[model samples]
Target: MNNLELTDNVSAAAKRDIFELQKKIGAFSNDEGAEEAFRKYRLTRGVYGQRQPGVQMIRIKLPYGYVTADQLVRIADCSDKYATGNLHATTRQDIQLHFVKLADSPQLWADLEDADITLREACGNTVRNVTASATAGIDPDEPFDVSPFAQAIFEYFLRNPISQEMGRKFKISLSSSEKDSALGFMHDVGLIAKMGKNENGQPVKGFKVVIGGGLGAQPFPAQTAYEFLPEDQAIPFIEAVIRVFDRYGERTRRHKARMKFLLNDLGLEKMMELVQEERTALKNKVYPVQDIAYSWKNLGERVPLAKEEILALADAQLEDSEKELFQKWLATNVFEQKQKGWYGVSLRVLLGDMHSSTARKLADVMRQYAADDLRVTINQGYLLKFVKAEDLPALFKALSQLGLADPGFDSTADITTCPGTDTCNLAISSSYGITRALEVMMKEEYPDLIYNNDIKIKISGCMNGCGQHSAANIGFHGSSIKNKKLVLPALQVILGGGFTGANSEGQMGDKVIKLPSKRGPEAMRTLLDDYQNNAYEDEYFNQYYARQTKNYFYQLLKPIADLSEVKDDEYRDWDHDELFKTEVGVGECAGVMIDLVGTTLIEADEKLSLAHEMLAEGVWADGIYHAYNTFITGAKALLIGEGISTNSQHSMVKEFEENFGKTFYPEAGDDSKPFSQLVFSINKNEPTEAFARGFVGKAEDFLKNVKAFRAGQLAENSIPALQELVYGQDS
Candidate 1:
């Protein structure tokens, strides 16, 4: 394995993760069930398979979208080194670099971790990046900053044992305030900052909590779990929730596996009861997060302008056009900070993509005119905080020079879109192409909409909702319609979906109609024109949509959806010269579980080794959890060898007892109980050193028995060995 030549300052854990990835990549070809096994492993480390073969997309996790200028420069450097020179900001507040070779993933990860940024758990069925409002700390309406709390949640779950191998991906959000800028209602756990008075009349910091929200083909609004949950118990409460999810979440039916499904199946009351049952095993009852806002000072090599130069630039005159553009930008993108005279500036990144050169320039701009704190917005833009009011002109000039100072920051023109057909396997059409066309049309025709914040336009390549289309006032997802035998790319028009500035009652767009990909621009124009002509004065887009009704909009757009007079270009999807074809591959937005008997046992052995290593490092909780995984993996291996379907951890436990509890592995020993009891003990006992040691010992004995039974089966030729199953016998 090739090791990184990183400085001693790099984290030991990061180095180990990289080394493990390299080792796995090296051994992949020889392992049985390698394709499925390796795919699951790499995804947890943030290396994802792209739509294009022989390349991967590396997702760099930026918790709460916070990035320093120096860190931005580092990311740019890595983008130039390991990927195409483009950096794509995702709606989840992550930076994704595409076209990375699988072998280079380890070094790319190492280079990123060298700058205190991580790729860990960035993509996978693990705890994804914890998001917050881009205006988190500085929002004028916020009760308190949610940055530190978001960071704490991110840190607590990154590589934590409870969330590593869940049945589906988990998402969490911490909105700055009741405005819910982070869209708290769309996450597994949504927390909005709230200040309350205690019994003694002292001010207490807490959150109004919501749980089990999600957006996909089927969207669900989160239920209000608590009106107020004290800040101190945040980590423990989340920990308990994840534990319950890990145990009970679905595995066989991929579509029915999100936490929302689990919540729906077992109601909120029953879910809370399970969470209460697991609280005794939590590591921290009260985790007090540190305030991170104090560390916003610039720390980069870029030089800043002198005080006199800044003053002069602030006072500098602008041309007529430049002045008009600047005024529009100020109206749309600039907002006052809660910290008196300072301002927050949002830079609208076209399609959420910028070249490496642009990123480096952005870093310099951050150092020159703004605080070191750079936030990636959920709308796929950049937010620079703590800019002095006087410095706005200089900042605007600098950003404009980079082609990033578009007037619309998060408006109708500022369309949120995912990398649909360009990189995602699930995307059915070209989101980038359609988004570009819409933006150009909007800029040329409806230039005044840049100042309109009441309407949101969002696009997703598919129904997966990575671009968060379901929550926008106007949304479109990629689809296809057949004309005779030819398939034409289409966009499903959705309307009336939006947040009402209240987390408890968020709306999801209703599907109105589908139009050919080429007609997407026309559809937007038609909607805008209709609203402008018939709506009540000062009415928002959603209100107009509500008034018009779904059938009304369908009738209105049914003309655009008509294929009777389709042009030749209509046969082709956006940005593609070739005719359209529906050729979507398997979606890896959330990696699926595919374990064979042979490789599953090997994985079990590996987990046992990890358990011992954790024990040696005195990480009792981690060790106990690893041992717990060992039990599940070993039991799963035997059941899979028997061709029994393994759907979920909880189900597998029950199935193992029903199938072979006292049959092949008879309960002869005095200490032997049901296999389910041994595994369930993890959540029943505290994670002390003694319990961890004993649990690991029990796991070792369990694995030995499993291996012995497997050997007997092999001797009888009842099951194929790893090599024979993967390759062939009689070499």
Candidate 2:
């Protein structure tokens, strides 16, 4: 189809967002004053500024990693046409296309939407891509598939007023079963499928919910929010929880802005109390998830290849070594589906990157051999489902030809690494280059580790854990160590992290030592040798680590940490010919810090407009939330104009009343209530039509008053004070 045809298929809301991006890009080129505001605006729509100037990275959100064969082909075409011809799959199950010009992004977003793909809320302080276990539908042990529920959450929150802007990003994961393959313990909100009995003794579907988990410079395990929350209440509960976060979560201090930090500051009980308060304002108390687009019942008709014919061909065509390898592949990469005769196959994607040509071919293979739904694995691979048992050999042969049939899907041999210095602005060292070296070393020296899936090796470009290094049995995050005159790229070796038991409890890795990047392979060999020779039989890596103690491993690897042994080549980072220099730029992973008082007022106006629109559409709760944000944003803007910074929305409300209540709302300051009470009424009142309309009207008046006050202040000589204020929390 032509670009116009593609654009014709775009949703009205999506088209408006894309057009806004296009306009913002033009505005930025003409006036640099729009940079910070445009940065925040573009990120919410998934356009990210890259390390290199004049280029952008676009992250495409695929809820639960569900992508059709046709969708894959479209993504490949976009990569070739707009971006570099490489598609990078991220750990959170999103695909990223990097090195695209900023001017091309709006069209890129438009083209992808033709395939029913979205870039909305893919970045920024919003609800990110909702992930689930790749084995959701086909897993033999799952109580019921979590895919539908995950999809429901993703849809409900996309463009929802509550999550449009927040202190920091939120992540949710739904695991197929208690095995927690989706790694729920590391998410802001994690749900594990559960089968429970009601008072009538009838089996009911629900989830064991966990909340406030995260990984970054510091990692926190999710705490149990509900031992068994009925499935219908999932979305509503999450909405209430997000409402609390949007109000109270840290905004100015970027480091402490995640939900986990908020949970730390306010204990779980207090947070839950706040969540209960917001419940009255929610659109639904029980939003039932009915069905998903990629449900099993919707798999289109397909003629299965005859079992006898395929097995016979397999016997005749396969050599002995190939047969042995096939068995190993079956043992590691393939699993019997819950649908007796069907199977699921995993293709180990090295470093989570695929060339467009190979991706197109893989899409073809997916169409012919597997179901249309292809799940991007959390470990940065692809999971193909609904393969018949008889077609295994033929499917394997097709994948082998494409060089995607690598064994050890999530084992030690399969290493996960972020783009690092190759593309990411925050990377201090090269995670990709070191990961490749470590993978090669593991294969050449310890190929048998493919049978060991218990030990996972993860690498990240930085301490933010994009590669999830903190969740690996053996982990490495990019860093640098200084020697007298020169700085050498270093890997901070971490051990004793991963899931512990059947419940999949998360353990953040402990930093053991720092070694020069070139010696990473040597460090791996030393750790592996020690684990291999001294561990109790069948003991997991973390178990062995506990027995040896952190000090023992530290002393053992202390020699490698010595800067005296560093060579001239050590000063050069891996895969680079030039001398290394620290080039870490401002990290955008937490989203841009909101600055500029006038811009804040403009954003408040936008929220006021959305409130009016939603109120007109009769979306009461959403309209109310938009109105609520309008109050906070307007108050924040006025406070910023006075050179008074506020951190959280809650703080901003109090600050507004304290500063302007006597002058603006004299009656409220005396006996009735303050500005805080008016705004805080959002959570206290139910979201009825009358309340929503009144709230939206109040928001409009508030913004109008704030803008008038700002105009009066600017009429005086207060423009410099208004513009110079930077909003943040006191350290």
Candidate 3:
């Protein structure tokens, strides 16, 4: 069946979501108050605000990096119609389209959903796309496929009430094998597939669970939460962990709102204890992941050349230069799959951006000479699977025509970068521009390094690490320097970071020095030249960097960092004609922040309603968590009204007790428990029907009292009215 013709069968839920988005978009024109709220809502549906004012960026969620040929064509068509004719494959295994008008997003989403693709929860504070190894089903080193597990998690969290409005965005990754090709260790939650035996000595599938890992201004390596967790318990365990984070994670301090920071504040032992405490409220103790049977058709059976013809072609190889090029392309870009007589070809996508025309051509190529399925790699590339070995030459020629058959696949010549100043609001310099300069320098001056995969180069617009600069062997993040009266774009050089070996133990880069953005290529050259000349035989870049230390590189690149010798051209940033200025906009990467007292109270009421709904549904754990959030939200609203800012939900609980507990309801039922103690009973009691009902009742009373208090303050003019305060402001 043609995948494109598969049916525009939109699920009722999806239809409702699309309709709601349309309504919100329509409402935004008349009601300015709805703009921020709508922006937040659209983000959860994958409509992100771009650096450009009038347009948006759409991110399409593709679980585990899996894409079918038909889906690719559909995306290409959408890009051509609704956005710039380009598709950017993100490191998280999602595809992004830029320069899309906000009004056209609904139609674009509908177009994608026609092919059963979704943009839901692709961004925002919700659980982002769940990723896994690109080679999951076919990797020779994999113990078993992780595709099903990743898909299960992706589905479970799509609109799960627990994660819809978290303190920060959550990420999850599953590796097919211990090799951790998915870069699992750097995600919010990482799962490594493992095989173990039960008490009866029968083999059982499981995962090595890691938590709180992330890449950002402050990168944290994930700590092992469980050496082995049974497959059946994975979902429930993950849900409990999220519940804990939701109730206790930071809220006001955006910078400290990630799971890693939460884990840092609460020791691993205490965090585990909290997770265990929430298990009683869980909707399921064990969720059995159904086996996924994945099969690919169209594995190119037709050989364009006969055996004798292929032999003749091989023997007639002509120029030594042509022969060497072919050999290099084969060695770097082609790898034998576990399946006999089949190979996987890696297509290096320059900076992860491919024009729609190129994408359609690649899809057509897949329909003819490879499997219908393709996997987008974590390093911003594509892996074409199930190609017949006999078709290698023809395939290379086809890809070469598309400018995708670059000899280096994930080698030093293959640089990874984020959109940076091109489209990211938080960027300090031009990451894409400097990246191009560096790549050209490497290919032109240090061509031999194309074969070296040990050294990776990654650049981020800023220290937020969107480009995963902290995970590179040699990294640069956008920064700036101050001269007497001017500012210049700069790159913060970092060293000694990357995957140490096949086991996937990752090391974060250390900041070495900052240099002018225009001189980034020279800085890279300096580091590579030093490593090449001084390193011992067989020493990898990371090992050599560790031996030389950060000071060594800082001293070597210090000349470039000297702002005293700044030239006139240094005043302009890469790819920019005007003088450099640090113009950063508020980042919506974590979702819009609503600070209106009334808006917050309304959110509290909504949480209360959701708690009631969950209680009716008999989802005890979910109800209890919702009630907990209701109390926190109500208290936060009142506190914010008093001009008291809260750094975290936990701190809000304490602050509310200190400020209002004694003045308001001083005691509760039996034993005269304080209001704070009563509200906190959520974590103390098991998630039973009785406890859920009682906690929800208390939350109801707490919200009522909070509303009454606010009314009295309003009547007395002691607090600013909603209209008096700046409302609907985007943060």
Best by TM-score: 2
Clashes of 1: 0
Candidate with the larger lDDT of 2 and 3: 2
Q: Number of the top candidate by lDDT? A: 2
Residue 393, candidate 3: C-alpha displacement in angstroms: 1.9
Provide the overall lDDT of each model, using Cα atoms, as 2-decimal numbers.
0.86, 0.87, 0.84
What does the lDDT come to for candidate 2? Answer: 0.87
Which portions of model 1 miss their true places by more than 4 Å? 1-3, 29-33, 297-315, 501-504, 664-673, 718-731
Better of 2 and 3 by TM-score: 2
Which lDDT tens digits does candidate 2 get at residues 1-731? 12332457789988888877787787787884457777888888898878898898999999999999899999999999999899899899999999998888888998899889999999998999999999998889999989999999999999999998899999999999988888888899999999988889999999999999898888888999999999999999999989999999999889899999999999999999999998888999899998765645655434544545555667776766677677678779988777766778999998899999999999999888888989998999999999876778888888888888888899889998899999889999999999889888889999998888888999998899999998888999999998898889999988988875456577788998998999999899999999999988878788899898999999999997887676889989889999999998877775665566778877887898899889889899989999999999898887887888878999988888888878668656355556887899998888999999998898888887887777677758666544333211220
lDDT of 1 by residue, 1-731 (tens): 56556656579888888888888888874563468888899999999989999999999999999999999999999999999999999889999999999888888888888899999999889999999999987888888888999999999998898798889999999988887788888899999899987789899899999999999999888899899988988888999999999889998899999999999999999999999988777787678778874565333222334445434554575555677687778778888677766778998998999899999999999888888889999999999987876677878888889999888889888999999999999999999999999999999999889978888899999999988889998999999999988999999888888763344357788989999989998899999999999989877777778877899999999989998888888999889999999989998867666656777887888899989999999999889988989999899888988889866899999888877887645744544656778789888888899999999999999987887777677768855554455324432
Q: List the residue pairs that clash in candidate 2.
A: none
**What would the TM-scores of all predictions be?**
0.94, 0.95, 0.91
What is the lDDT for 470 in model 3?
91
